[model samples]
Target: MTSDILLLEKNMHINVFGLNHNTAPIEIREKLYCSESDVPVILKKLKDWGLYESVVISTCNRTEIYFCSDDSNNSEESIKKIDAFLMEHFGVALDWLKNYTYRFCDEEAYRHLFLVASGLDSMVIGEPQILGQVKDAYRMATFHNTTGFFLDKAFHKTFNVAKRIRTETRIGYNPLSISSMAIELSKKIFGELNRKKILVIGAGEMCEIALKYFKKEGLTGIFITNRTFQHAQKLAEDITGIPCPLQDIPDLLTKVDMVLSSTGSEKPIIDKELVVSIMKKRKNRPLFFIDIAMPRDIDPEVNHIENVYLYDIDDLKGLSQQHLSDRLKESEKAHTIIEEEVVKFSHWLEQLEKNPLITHIIDVVEETRSNELKRMMQKMKYVDEETLRNMDLLTRSIVNKLIHRHISLIRQNGSPSLLEIMKQLFKFEEENEKEMDSGNEGK
Candidate 1:
């Protein structure tokens, strides 16, 4: 029901609307982020809103909502649906969100997602972690059965494009991640990491990356504590750090110089009261906390306490943002890759749209052949078997020849206008839909 400019075709198309690291600050991004638990609920809400084909990509740097719908004619209406859902779930109104967010439709929306999956849109510029994060989000969507045919196809293609970009270009070479920035932040504060006792919370990918970065540093004691002891022990064994239970965090808090947490907890694991008591044990020594988790594993109140510092994922972005010129060069190479892939995907989409017309062409020719053969038979005396066989063969050849050139032209790469011409040349689909609607009304 949207205008022609917004409508991609008469059917569903991939749509993306969200705020990312470039468009929004960390605070804004975090407020919009949907955690692993939150993704399904938000996706379900969107489904209930008739956005049955959708996916949510929420990370430290971005919170994106992608879905399939027919509001290309007026994307604001489609975006309003997403905006309303966000208002309902994330508590941000449409006007407030529009300033920070961007919207893309059809091919452009799909292209944007490909760039995101390939890490061309990341703060670090071609960071490798985003591809995996995107994959994980799609996997979650698949698990919940939220994505429909279009999304599933687009996301799968996006994964392949991301893989190609990483392989074909130097985009991922010498990349930086949020975990590396956290380590750099620590060095900035302590001037050196040689004597800093580090405690890592959680055994997730973020925590693993932080530990990997920390091991390379000259840090003194490294401790691993997580809710799952087996995971904690495994990471600690690999990193040669001591493994501790989640309960041991209070004791570790007192002894450690820095605590890097990346947990899946909904609530803050470290509060002001707990940290204040721990600081008392250390004679008011300074403690640095880096919380990379989405829901925030460390409380903001903890930052207010004396001799304690707290940094979330957003704070880490500043460190990674430096020297953007070098990464931007690599980003250009990724852009070229994405452009090629976008064209490739668009071609596939056009071919898919034209397929129905091709089917109709074949059907029309076959029906004409059948009706003409029956008339000729009625006008002649008992036809011989050989004559009948020859007639059938002759009609089949004529039909194939008649439509061959038209089908060939449709298959070739041409201007965008060619598709509209092909649709106009074949009116069967539109007529069929009209007849079906009329019949339903009559019934």
Candidate 2:
């Protein structure tokens, strides 16, 4: 490859290093959980460490860092650096990083991103929330000026691919999100949801969405609480539910038959001790808990309490399979769309790599054609507008036809030998100057 092509290929070195729902359990994923504020810091850190482009996406189910550098050969070292950074920043163990994390480079990395943005790789197949999360991540990266040309194109293409899947396939038809699935599981635990009451902790997007599902089921006495009381009030107002302060969780827990929690809290908010006391106040009324938050808002030990059932994100996985079965056909279609986009994206990168030489080739050929045409026109007495137009069209067509094969060759396989030949053929500066001088003398 020529130096330009080599440089282009180097800049295409995109990679992702992190853990997701499939590769890591909730415990491992939460350890690397990057909140919104953490992304800019991580992006700046990566950039400081010499990455050209980077984006960090950390949701309840996955924590992934997508980055690129103009050193394809050093991808291994770069990924190792990212691994060590995650270990140190998240305080995760080496064993967990080795066993629970996954890394992908170039094509595989972009493919995984497409799967994620399209929700094909979600815990619940065809979930739509992940797309919004991916968009938010991309937006943050761009705001921090961490994404460059390659990542910008890749992410834009990813959005297009996701949109195509959404329009072409019915993957999102009656979609099942983590919240929806949690509601489904709750129905199994407590039949006739309309008769039972539920308390939703944390008024974030997930909690808000879950409340809507709960309301649709005609659930009575919906209570919402959050660390920021205003957010809880806003969500409750939107859903016609009751709003309470975070400190009131203990009181609310005793009255509601179920508790659905999804928050950004870094630790378990409702522990065994708290639940133990709440259960007594409720007379042990079989209160079910859905802890969908990343760090797990409810303690896992709470499951052992009598008449109390607990389900975290991992527990929701079993329920997802049932939803997946219904959307398998659509999921397959979405995967097909992703494969097509990946191939197109690869071709685009190849074209980008070969563009410098291609542009030179076109410039030389077009200038040569223009000089020759000028020389012919100078030889003639005068050319009418119709004749001039015809000649111009004929000359342009001939030039394009002659150069088309060479351009295709560069795009398909930009080998060093071929690049050198095109370079030599198109380096007509001295000859073009002489030809133009001769044409001017004739004039």
Candidate 3:
């Protein structure tokens, strides 16, 4: 882990432990949700406890803790402390949570972070939201110089990798928007959306994006309703649709051909009984329902109804998987770009390793020449101060010229083996000088 490889440096001392969507259900995820307001307090708590440097990234899909320290012996203890803090804060049992958590250290942690930034670990492959969330977390960690040299470099590299992924691959092309996929799936079952009277049950961002796709597909006779009638009305006007109050959803269900519901409600908005009644009222007409909410706005049992098609978030996972497979095929090119970047990063790390030693040697040589010239000037006091200064400059220039070729050779051709030799040589010289000084001290 060279100093020049910033990600490795920052993460070289970092320990990460967290649970993500793959390991936890919505019930568990909701419990671990740390609001934006809680970030500063959490950081302060970690720092106060001697964690020193820390960053918390809590999102819908993942919650990760990245903390830095020099104490290897306390690494496990620090992770345990973090786990205890989360258990206390979220009121979740440590037994239930521990199984889902993954702890990474050093180079593995650095690689995992890079993969996360590249969007390879996202629930929705190539989703753009995670990168923004990561950037926000990075920005928050920058306060009070908590980021340091390693984190600063690692994050910048992550951002650059994200940019390269976006540019070099078609991973983002033809992305399966949740709303658009719902409409497209409906079309597959029942022809075009032009004649369908679509009813959106909430005015959430997902519902809005869905509506935009529907409108673009020539969808008309749209109706929107929310708990807050004003929000529903605003969304309705924006899409040139009808606005209804939340209570009217039961009545609206029978009239509309398609229903898209995404509310922040804790319980199901549309149940099996309601859909069964609506299907009866519509005289066997096909009805499509999409529940894009976390706790699920629609009941899973609604799928049992005849002529009723119900799709929840989990249902969309299959479609997302298909899109991800397609994106993966395109990602081969992006992986090539990443490989090229890794090589470039490795070369830079090597150059940085050679720089400090060269600089130290140059400084030592220059200082020696300066001291020698000062002694010579004192002995030949008749020489004018101007002439003495010129001689001093001339000697310094001569030393620099003599060392330039050696410095250039090391910078251009230095390997790990060569660096090891240089380090040993420096150590030997220092040890020999110390021995000589001890001998003189005895006299």
Which candidate leads the pack in lDDT? 2
Pairwise lDDT winner, candidates 1 and 2: 2
Q: Which stretches of candidate 2 lie over 4 Å from their true place?
A: 1-11, 177-323, 357-443
lDDT value for candidate 3? 0.73
State the lDDT of candidate 2 residue by residue for 337-410, as single tens digits: 88998999898677766465564566567668778988998998778755765675577668868887988887
Assess the local accuracy of residue 86 in candidate 2 as a C-alpha lDDT between 0 and 100: 75
Q: Candidate 2 — what's its lDDT?
A: 0.80
lDDT on C-alpha atoms for all candidate structures: 0.78, 0.80, 0.73
Per-candidate total of colliding backbone pairs: 6, 0, 0
- Per-prediction TM-score: 0.51, 0.53, 0.51
- The C-alpha stretches of model 1 lying farther than 4 A from their native spots are 1-9, 71-74, 177-211, 214-326, 357-443
Candidate with more favorable, higher TM-score: 1 or 2: 2
Winner on TM-score between 2 and 3 is 2
Q: Quote model 1's TM-score.
A: 0.51
Task: Return the top candidate by TM-score.
Answer: 2
Residue 140, model 1, lDDT:
76
